[model samples]
Target: MHPHSPDESPAPRPAGSPRSIDPRRLRADDLRYLLAVSRTGRLVTAADALGVDHTTVSRRVAALEKSIGLRLIERGPDGWTLTEIGRAISDSARVIEEAIDRVVDTVEGQDSLSLHGTVRVSAPDGFGTAFATPALVRVRRHHPQLQVELITATRQLALRPSGFDLAVVIGVPAGSRLVTEHLTDYTLGLYACDDYLAKYGRPKSLAELREHPLIFYIESMLQVGDLDIERHLPGMTPAFSSTNVFAQLEATQQGAGIGVLPAFLTQRTQLRRLLPDEIDIRLPITLAVRREAVTHAAVRALWAALRQEVAERADELLLE
Candidate 1:
């Protein structure tokens, strides 16, 4: 006789198989999977929403039914529907989910004001250097135990739960996994050093702007297309280009060329605004973080500090 195959010890159960079950054996995963199915009414959709495969969702639902000792779902060619028992249990699952979220919020809230743990923040080079760094200095002074690592780059930082605790963004982020809050709107104006204007002759009109050398963002390295200041002055090109805003600012300060800079930078510097009356540009600022990271105390503390810092310094950030 052929040897029995170990894998054939028992055949896999088909959908809605009749079998004995123990309700007390169910776990939180079982309930959550059931809730997903209840909300979506299809295994494929539920799997997609929960970031799992349809097979996993089917197995989870089957396991939940087996543990509850009842068939809570009616599966058909069209879709799945919760039976009366399934609906009742799904309602309970929602309550359980809410309760769990509340528990997490309470724990996180209790420690929201905590002065511990490291928070990693990502922001644009200009904002990070000219604004975020100084604000963080005050945040650090208040929370001696808390540490901050500010990552600055010209391109948008890839947002991930493991990457950064928070990000200050100039444009709307692409992914759905991140939650965003409007931080503030700020203005930018064309500026040049007194020496540069004296040498190059200040342009009194938009049409005269091209006569002067311009310092602007490097086109190849530009991430946000709206940041191309030359867009406002058609046919204009930069005499000097850099990926870093601070570099452009310095170049402008050294009388290399006129550069469009944030109001906050210009207000702090002795740079003279060129055609200030004609050039009016406004950009929105947003604070973003992974939805999963919102419950962390360190993230919350940093978020509050960033908001407060922006609000307190609105005069410096926004144009008059």
Candidate 2:
């Protein structure tokens, strides 16, 4: 984060002498330091973010501008602002910084446990809303500077550069470039409201489940085909279908029909698990990150936090 700066600017190329721009003058450390200053707009704040002194940040910026032969930034009473050329250069530098960081992570494993900056996570809507969100909140409490972005979607997300920093998925990833690990296994069982059971009667066995209507996922919209509960129960059909688990859960609660629900999501509701002994369905949850991010400090910390939290709450998550 910190790079030595020269107090004096380098002597300008002699007038009319061919001014050669040596690419070597633009160092990765210098670019990263400038990128930090550009983001924070203040030397002290940028220094704090990079864990360096303000003077080091200022000197590095000055040195970068000198070596590049362009004024990359301007500082005044209004705070720091990048020049027209500075903006373009800084933007390019940011990309290089990211690539360099990834390379560094690839070479040296996770180096720090201190979580900072932002980590974007993608997960299934149900788990992201009911489970991962709360767990990430706890992680934020431990590292106040860490920011977590949880994107919940019905479809499986891609694990690659420009995608989510981390993904918690229900099944396996398609590509080999992603680093995936089994997080935990959760249980899903047939559940229905007490009112519904009283009115329609609970199924006594898997074979009897056909007598009652089913509330389940829409076949065409299912992100993971295995989640189509009726596939596990032969000759069964859905009387009510939805792509959203929450909607299906709500309908099931209103005495609509029996629905397969994650056990943790139903714990606080009045729904009763039906034929638990016969209909215990387990789904393995996997945590995936781009291979390049396996050694990233912030990503590693976030991954560790999620794994620890999920494991600690296995009873609630896995229905043990």
- Expressed as tens digits, the lDDT of each residue in 180-200 for candidate 2 is 899888888889998988888
Which stretches in model 1 have alpha-carbon errors above 4 Å?
1-113, 157-162
Scored by CA lDDT, what does every candidate get?
0.72, 0.74
- Model 1: worst 10 consecutive residues (lDDT sum): 1-10
Scored by lDDT, the top model is: 2
- Residues 112-156 of candidate 1 have per-residue lDDT tens digits of 344554567788888888678878887788767566878887666
Cα shift from native, residue 55, model 2 (Å): 33
